[model samples]
Target: MEFFNKTGKVAVGSRLRMLTEKITEDAAKIYEVYGIGLQPKWFPVFYVLSAGEEKTITAIAKEIGHSHPSVSKIIAEMGKKGLVAEQKDKTDGRRNMVSLTPKGKEITIKLQDQLLDVNAAIEAISAQTTHDLWKAIEEWEYLLEQQSLLSRVVEAHKKREAAKVTIVDYQPKYKAAFKALNEEWISTWFKMEATDYKSLDHPEEYILDRGGHIFVALYNDEPLGVCALVKMDDPDYDYELAKMAVSPKAQGKSIGWLLGQAIIEKAKQLGAKNIYLESNTILKPAISLYNKLGFKKVPGRPTPYERANIQMELDLRS
Candidate 1:
């Protein structure tokens, strides 16, 4: 517990492992006291086979909520201990069937009586705790299922790395990244056309000089993502969200989300009522990101780019 004073904030895995080891140590001793020749690790497999029915290896793994290889290893270990029997299915040589042997059935009889006392012992211990440990563990498991620890940590790391991405206004030096990033994505998915070149090759004349704004995301002094808000004269919309592209090498770093958020904020600052965008349905990730930013599909308008099949708009008033 003294180690918690320094590393409690990041010691969740350590703490869980410590508790598991302590419980397993006591469980082994408890099994010995009951004269049950079972390892704590083998309890789950034993429980599954205790139903007195033969099940395929895959079925056993599914019932126990474990991986096939892991369950197979445990079953093999139990088979060696004479607690379980396994054989290849008569119809299918590839499928293995497992069930409790005579020795296993006898052990289950002893385990039934032993578990009754163990359950009460566990309840007695739970009564002394400030929080219901079993319920807390169940909740923790549900939360982890909703979003695994790996996914949570990766997302956090992405946000942390994205913090280093500095959003800057269009500059002469960034014009290369502005063009290159767009060209990379467009040429990868769709053929670049005159409209694409007009904005990408000459941002100043096509977008900037027309009172539109372009933002570039730079990480470690390298510009990797760019998005432009083009000024429009349409009464229904003020600006068109266009030419957004993040480099292939720079994806999954939250660069696109950051750039999109920045452009939306810039549109609000410019007193825009609605922002419009055009994209192909094949670009699902881009569509999803736009939806996250509150953009919804709207009726299409006449467009110049052949790649533009879907139109969406964001109502700023909402």
Candidate 2:
């Protein structure tokens, strides 16, 4: 049995990167299930606060992998939610120091205990396994720190926003161009697997078989693009915008934008206040589209997808 040989930092880095998401997601779920009172986005804030030092927003943002505005917004929200408090730094009147409140401290202690328990569980399962897990995670964090992953994530996020697509709902005949459109895009742009552009035989299966919706972008009788509104299991969550694809031949025409607008409108029509999309950073244009449509950067470890690698959401007041 012969195996292919591989070496180099990118190869190692890429392999390790896969764990970045799965571990982050598992950690978040554990914290949430334990009622730890902190969202994944606030992990860096918690880490900073745990250091027992009063830090300004600028310092905190710099230390963590997040933009100043992003940190400020999360901090503001945390304060509102009673997780933290803000006070002017007496030594420097211009600087505001953010620190955990009494409640925040209490929550942090609980989270710390939960963290220890999680570690203990892993250790109990196997000491060697526990050590390797921490080692890999630490290396991944160090790499992200060196690369300023937050900034890259932010930039990637901005690209998605700039690619905002408006959605519109119309008849199937109006979408006759969808088949050709996907074929061109798959061939020219993404070089996607053949399976990526397959047609949905059971249109009603999408609409009624499970949580689903249908949206089509029409250029007269031509279907320039298509997207779906998928219902998730979480009641607190609204529907997700999935299966977004554009015609390779119509890439620059903003047909994708029309589809986005249509999805939002349709989501509102269904009484949904939040709409989300799943995509990837590699597809820079798609990420830009989501950002331009009002999606904010969320600290989520995204999984792979054929055409996208990032997940974004829009809040609608209806």
Candidate 3:
């Protein structure tokens, strides 16, 4: 009777749901102080309320990506809890309109405040991490939306499509080649002189050395770009970003931002509270990408690398 029984697809789907539930539980716990029943299942209702539209059950269900029947059941439950109410649609007696009660609206404001507090706390932990979190969320949302669109297309013949990647680890085989590529990239892409060879080590060695990682973009089986993470030994410093570059052929692809993102994720995974970068203002495009990725200007130590005339750092936890 269970069509999905023992299916790999079913298992994968269930696991994803379980992970989502766990995250939802954590968020709900954080927001519990607001005294609103802001549980995982109620997110659709809250989203509707925030959108501020009085809509029929069918319309609300479609907007929230749920079935009308399921949405109706949720509305009924919310009504019982005094969070929402349903009234017969004047234009269509068969349809019921849904709206948030005053209590629901009041609780939403508190939840918003709690969310802002969460952002601030994250930012307080690490500047590099703050930007990383936002970028990660942005990437996650982009992928989710992309997947949803692909799903719709597939349900109709099929359809498709692709990171500012943060660099985490470097490939030893590509080290010498990447270093050369990095130098070429800095000169060509950022119009800065390349200097300093801290020594030849495998990408893994550097990753472990810095308590971070590295990443490379490849084209035609050749290393085309690279980035890295360097942890701060001092508690006051948090972390530092280093050795990011992309080949001339890879220019205009925004691969640097992708490498930057990879670096951010690496730092986050390594338990870094903040991540800072050393760079120059003349690298306008790179700076713009960083800002778009949520990196803000902050006073910091100058780049020790001879070519870096400007230095910028980002808080990671936010």
Candidate 4:
């Protein structure tokens, strides 16, 4: 009963239909009050014919922004009521020209006076709003022309789905995924070193067995990314956040952010005093992400991996 109010813009098509029905309903009442025996839907075609311009069905449809079949149906109904007549074009036998009959012209004359009142009533309603509804409609149509509503809707859907990515703890099924995902990114940027192979080849021995954790990002149960929190030998509570990688297809979807957050949270849960990571300066986006997660640059130190030229650390205590 109150679908328009409940759904609002989410159901724009339905709301527009409801608004049209309301206007048409009022117009029908106005017609009855003025003793005009005409339906509101017939007004457009009737007014066009009343201008004394004989038009073909295609021309009438184009002028009124309706389909040819719809205009033809209306013309047929008006013909039955003796308000309109269709005549074959002399020059083109296939074309039928439509014109108002004598009775239709008489009805148009009677309705002309009532039309002013209808126009005034509609204008009065529009004046009640702060913004002009008609002007807003024109702007909305122009915007739709520039970029269709369907395109905007599809973009919004993609964003929503991208945001829906989840960080999941490593499971037995994801054992190979943990290595494959990390290898995919590492091989793309730099060749995997012995240290990388040691950890990736034996995640259980080097990671899980050493009181560390691995977290994976999943979208609809498909593994998209992974990050590991390795317990340090110097400080039992310190963790090295490493081996982070997101699949190429899911790279731009913030799966990396989700994976980073999950590992950071895991570090906190493990009572980590600080989380450290090593990276190369060429990885600007990754560095930016680290900075966003409260990682601050620290003095560079000798690292096992040749590619490690930058060092950063997040002090959880502060």
- lDDT of each model, Cα atoms only? 0.92, 0.70, 0.67, 0.88
Name model 1 segments beyond 4 Å from true.
Answer: 1-11, 18-26, 51-63, 76-82, 85-99, 116-132, 233-236
Candidate 3 accuracy as TM-score: 0.43
lDDT (Cα, tens digit) per residue for candidate 2, span 36-75 = 7677778888779876688899999899868999999999
lDDT by residue for model 4 (1-318), tens: 486667677888877897899888988998899888888899899988899988998999999989999999999999999999999998999999999999999998999889788789779988897889889999998999999998898778767877778887888789899999888878888899999999998998999999999998888889988999988886433889999988888855777777788888888887789999999888888999999999988988778999899999999999
Predicted candidate 3 versus true structure: per-residue lDDT over 1-318, tens digit per residue? 254455655365576677678777777787676565766687776777665678887788778789978888888888888888778889989877788888877777777777688779767856755357557757967887878745654443311111332333555677786668766756564543423344224455545465756677665556677766766676656677777677766664556766777777767777777777767677777778778767777765645566566656677667
Ranking by lDDT: 1, 4, 2, 3
lDDT of 1 by residue, 92-199 (tens): 899878999999999999998899999999999999989999999899899999999999999999988888899999999999989999999999998989999899
Model 4's alpha-carbon lDDT is: 0.88
Q: Quick one: how many clashes does candidate 1 have?
A: 0
Local lDDT at 186 for model 4: 83
Q: How many residue pairs clash in all the candidates, one count each?
A: 0, 31, 37, 0
If scored against the real structure, what TM-score would every candidate get? 0.79, 0.40, 0.43, 0.54
| Residue-level lDDT for 138 in candidate 3 | 78
Q: Higher lDDT: candidate 1 or 2? A: 1
In the order shown, what is each candidate's alpha-carbon RMSD?
3.7, 22.2, 19.1, 11.6
**CA lDDT for candidate 3:** 0.67
Worst 10 residues of 2 by lDDT: 1-10
- Between prediction 2 and prediction 4, the one with superior TM-score is 4
- Residue pairs in clash, model 4: none
